[model samples]
Target chain A: MMLHNALDRYHDRPSSIHDLDPRVKVVVTLLGIFSVLLLPDGAWGAYFLVWCAVLAVALVARLGVGLVLRRSLVALPFALVAITLVFTLPGRTLFTLQLGAWEISASDAGLVRFSSVLVRSWLSVQMAILLVATTRIPDLLHALRHLHVPALLVTILAFMVRYLAVLLDEVTRLLRARQARSAASAQGKAGGSLLWRARVAGNMTGQLFLRSLERSDRIYNAMVARGFRGQYVTINPHRMRRRDWMALGLAFAALTMIQWLGRTLS
Target chain B: MNIALLTRLWEEVVVPRMHIPDGFLSMPVALIFWVITVALLLLAIRKTQQQLGERQIPLMGVMAAFIFAAQMINFPIAGGTSGHLLGGVLAAVMLGPWAGMLVMACVIIVQGLLFQDGGLLVMGANIFNMGLVTAALGSLYHGLAARQSKGVRLVVAGVLAWLSVVAGALFTALQLGFSGTSPFAIVVPAMLGVHMLIGIGEGLITMAALAFVMQVRPDLVAAEAVRTGGGRGWVIVGLVIALFVAVLSPIASADPDGLERVAIDMGFEEVAMTPPYELFPDYVIPFLGETPLSTILAGVIGALVVALVAFAVGRLLRQRAAAA
Candidate 1:
């Protein structure tokens, strides 16, 4: 299946970061990212340290350096938005580039603001990628359930994870069929106009939704027939071990100090 | 438009990406929105669970997955580019508002968790912008779409969908303004202008889908209508917000050049001189202008737009209920 393992990029490992309870890993990753954002803009010291810290985490988790870097590129377009602001910002123009009638100037203040937002998003996503890569989705859902998330929300999330890949495959197949039909039509004539394609897209969406609704109807009926009650129940008896707490506390304290020092020293 | 600027706009401002990334919002502003979103989400969860019962739980998952998958399918816009469905209104049309909100919440949670499509710190803000706000507008639009002539239904659905996207963009500008990261004045007109065009595309897609459902699967929407029998709640919500903004806009705009204050934070509030369309030069970015009258005028215009859209939404919901 082309869609297999497309979303589940989990790297199973027995390393310390990988072995941490998913709850601990989630909490630590959140705290770590929050602290990273809290670091004042232009605090290069804080940003560099956090970057190194996340890299260390990735390393400990047996995640390849290249994978984390590549995954972190998802936020680069957003960073480009910030970078675009650097030229328009009101400040001393550090440099200017003229092309045609346009004068594009990069301001020093704008550069500072842009880079701050850029690094912040970049580093935050890196930590997030590391968290997901090390922890299994099952463990993550179990952790959410253990963390006192409502049963219904947790149940829904469980179903979401289970069927997300399946739905992706279904959609991919649908897309291929659409492409085949479109290409066949194109060979005989020009492809449809924008409106025509939009209607087709809409039809495809309607069809997919109908299929999903029918599928869910069947799934629900089957569950009810199998004597399923109104409650969605899952049993997992995984306690937070001492090592989990220790790891979280130490990481928490270190991140806190890094943020504090970044604010003061900068 | 300069080729460079056009591409930059496409890459940065014109992103089909629904959720805002981290660092665009400051700590306090994000946290405040997060708290509000969390409270709203709790109520939605409670209501959805009550309405859906336990039997409908599996369907929530399927629906969530379906929306997630659909978002990945990008349809071609003009210019060889494409935009995907935000799907909030579509979800509301299929499932009622509260359940729609839950489905949206699930999709966002999955997107953030699995793909990191949005930042974790700003996930709450993302949920608010892309999910909650859209759901509120969708349900309200659904209400307006009720019992009307087919033409009215098409026009209203398309306009409301467009307006919802624009409204989401406006709220995004407000949030960015509140964060002191970007001044409201420049961001408002700029974001609004781009989103207005984006909204038209959104409207077309939504109308097409509505037409499809109207023909083939009225039953799917029937279940949704039964859940959405809450009359005038949407009106009250719209009125309160409009009134609140109209009341507070003056005080908020008391200092005309809030950009100076924002300059201390990051310094990038250049005026967007090449706005594709200027509604009115004076009120383009209302608060930044010289007159409180202009701000209030803009606020009134805003209020009127909300009321009109809300009315359409109310009518739509009533129509759907009657049809079902």
Candidate 2:
């Protein structure tokens, strides 16, 4: 996937949700994840509620239903793995099928477990997607810093996000160069050897590492010249507005309601 | 190695090679792994600062990106399950082991946090399994092998890559066993059997990658060369062994993995969870199933959207900073 294009989408006008303080968003997202994960494994109803709540949040945030569904799809594999357990699990078999040497029997408990996993994953992923969609990476980092996350970790994340596109660009360029050279060599010879291709790919990776190191040294030297310090200072401090507090209160209320509903249902 | 020593090393030093994903692990096991991961991450940051100065930041960032991109590409393996290079060991061989660990740790952290690729609580477990164990063990293997012949070093690299996966799988089984999810006897053998095959793929990829690095930019392999006393013979030897292992791996194991085996043996097979709305029961969206196909389509679309969103965010920050 093209890294630059992926990054370019984040620059959209900050939605009302995006305008909220990053801390509020972070807390809400964490709460959403925690609530879903804490649901009992067999609690399919609780999971459905969570799914509905996530959909509601997405709707309020004006995030496209299609987009949220798409993002949640990343968790599909785990869901399938859970589904497999339904047939493989031994219990009062809901249904049985004989295939080759294996007898697959679906269990009611297995289906419940699968449903719970599916619901939990969907809710958690929605929260994450919404959080990332709303908050800029820098704002998120700033929030992380204020939340008492280690400065080094935050700095590392910020830089990694920032430089990812650049690195991708460099790799792409390197690949093109290699492809051109390979095609020329192949034209001269009948076919390119697999051994040679492997060696060439290996060389490119090494070169990339060296280039990255050299770039870092240069960047460091420049920073040093500009009176570099160990840590970076925020240019514009993120202030928590009244709306931010309101958002946080509402999130807490929603979570409390969900927990109460879960208890009542159980 | 003595059996006791081997067991100790496997448990303490090597086994947490980091390939196991979440949902495969129980909650208690995940928590323990998380605790260990956090502790190791704290240690890694401290160690990194001592060895690397300001110059390392950009380098670390670029390397993290490279690893991120590399992970996206998976090569098909046996049993319809695909495998990707863990790359922690490979990264460690080039960068110092600690620095390599730090990079891997960051990648896992981001993957866990952003993509929800792994669970938040179990992130530590994932990090320990993938980053700390693999990098440390791979580095150790390289260090010792380099002392012998270059061919031996390559073989060691390949073998270690395979071993790392086996080690990772075994640790995962132990965690499951310890959590009272599955018995050790069933879990261990099952995990070891499949991972041994997977490890061969890992070994080949790693050795080939390392050999290429050695040939192209000898400087990137400088750290490794220094550790190996600049032995060229051992490097070449290592390359040959890698080729041999790659050709031999297909004939190895032809069975379902440890997790699958335990899943089949224990009635608790239903305990394993998959992501929601996934197309195939495994994560792959079959070229059929409208709901699952749409989901896969959405993922491709979502990835594009995420990339765009991330880029825009970066540009906005840069602009705001410049304006300020």
Candidate 3:
């Protein structure tokens, strides 16, 4: 239950962003990300404007700006992999440091590229986090289905999200069982060789797989008894209201203006 | 443990954690992969739909959920480190390749959209590298070892699982290099170095999991369904080889130091200098001028052309085989 809450970060606060059509939200989020991606490296003015737009959306959603900023840090670790660009890209050398025998110099161009990557990914993640926080998972999946993503793929996504909590609970209990059985030393470390621990985890994974499969079978039997077919029926008809269209138009205008600003600034 | 240390451990020590976030790739590179991933996804849908019955849909869905949850079980590795299962190969063996690809795609998509673990635009690359490549290799090797003894099949699964991880990492490195986000010489080695070790964990876990499944619900594993005919097997092999050659061609051309050194050693350097016309001279489009972007563009065009030609040749060979 704690894990479920932890995973589902959606806050049920009534706000303009949450009330927008999920499909429009998905499209606008994607448009924001694409604009961020398309902005040239080192476009500081455009980057600032985009951040402003993102913050504006966060404010509208009533999600604290600090929370979104903190959550966006998840993209940083992966961005660190691009650190090599600082030394490898050709440009005027910014500085040089002696690393044992080799002298490494960071290029000005490389620094710009690397920092822009960090900024772009950071901003993009904020948009994504805001989308997920505002829209419920099922609504988002429905939006995806309506957006012409593959039907089977959408169905599978639906089921996965549906059962993620149940399976995660099962995994939690399994981990608990393992912990109870694991013998702790004076240092409070579980007593096992590396291979033993790996084998134990693998067995648990395998056990989980078997249990999930059997559960699916039972689910299928129950569905069949209820005259369930392969297709899923949508209870609520999704229609984009006037405000949804207005929001979409506003987003496109804003993205265009931001892009134009980027070009003009550069 | 404190939250900071836990977060650090989660970020750093996780093995084979190569979900490419946004802004890491160039626009063209990301768009190309999006095209490739979508094409393959459509194909997977068609193939799975044709073969899968109504009951299998729920099974596929639950199995996707299983892969997501199973990723949480971190197996202890050396030096107090831990690794987790990606489960691409396991899913392929369990649900067969086409359905398995769907499962992996679903997990990657949800991770991107909900968890922000990956970027939305670069998701195509993420799904391609982690989902399509792993499932294809898993099915290829598993189908090859299908009729063998259980021990042999397990060994194949373990080795192929390891190979799949390395292969995914290699492609990620290639994509980064092509996008000009990172230099090829550095990123390739770094990515491969980490994944090569992590892959052993993948191998062990895959083997252990397969063995466990074999012992318990023997009927659940779909090894029989994965086995393909001789022609289809050749097509897969041919496509893989073509893909390898296409991916490697640009790198080979870019660094011909070995051949150049050989020419000098043989006293043929002077003789080799004359009569060749300039086509993509120095791997740059002449009109676009000398820039990294132009070189990357030229390289993409070159790779695409080679892959297309090889695909045509393979298609012709397949047609001939069918005619015979």
Superposed on all Cα atoms, the candidates' RMSDs to the truth, in angstroms, are: 6.7, 15.0, 9.1
> Among the candidates, what TM-score does chain A have in each?
0.90, 0.86, 0.94
Candidate 3 lDDT over residue span A1-266, tens digit each: 22243335555788999999999999999999999999988899999999998899999888878978988888787765778777766678899877544567777887988898899989999999989888887788889989999778888887778787788778777876786898677877665777777788889989999899889999889989988788677896789999999999999999999999898889
In terms of docking quality, how is candidate 2 classified? incorrect
Q: TM-score of each candidate?
A: 0.84, 0.73, 0.84
Candidate number achieving the greatest lDDT relative to the actual structure:
3
lDDT of 3 by residue, B173-202 (tens): 777766667655455545655675677788
Candidate 3's TM-score on the B chain: 0.71
User: DockQ for all models, in order?
Assistant: 0.38, 0.14, 0.46
For residues B1-324, could you state the per-residue lDDT of candidate 2 as single tens digits?
Answer: 133432232222122233333444555566767787778778878877876777677667667767654543233444445445667767676676667788888777776665556666466787877677766655554434544455666766676676566556555555654433333333334445556556666676677777766666655565654642413332333333333223222211112244345544554433443212211232222232223333343244234334433543454476589899
Tens-place lDDT per residue, model 2, A113-175, is 556656666677777777876677778778989998777777777666766666656655675
- Cα distance off (Å), candidate 1, residue B143: 2.5
Q: Candidate 3 has which clashing residue pairs, if any?
A: none
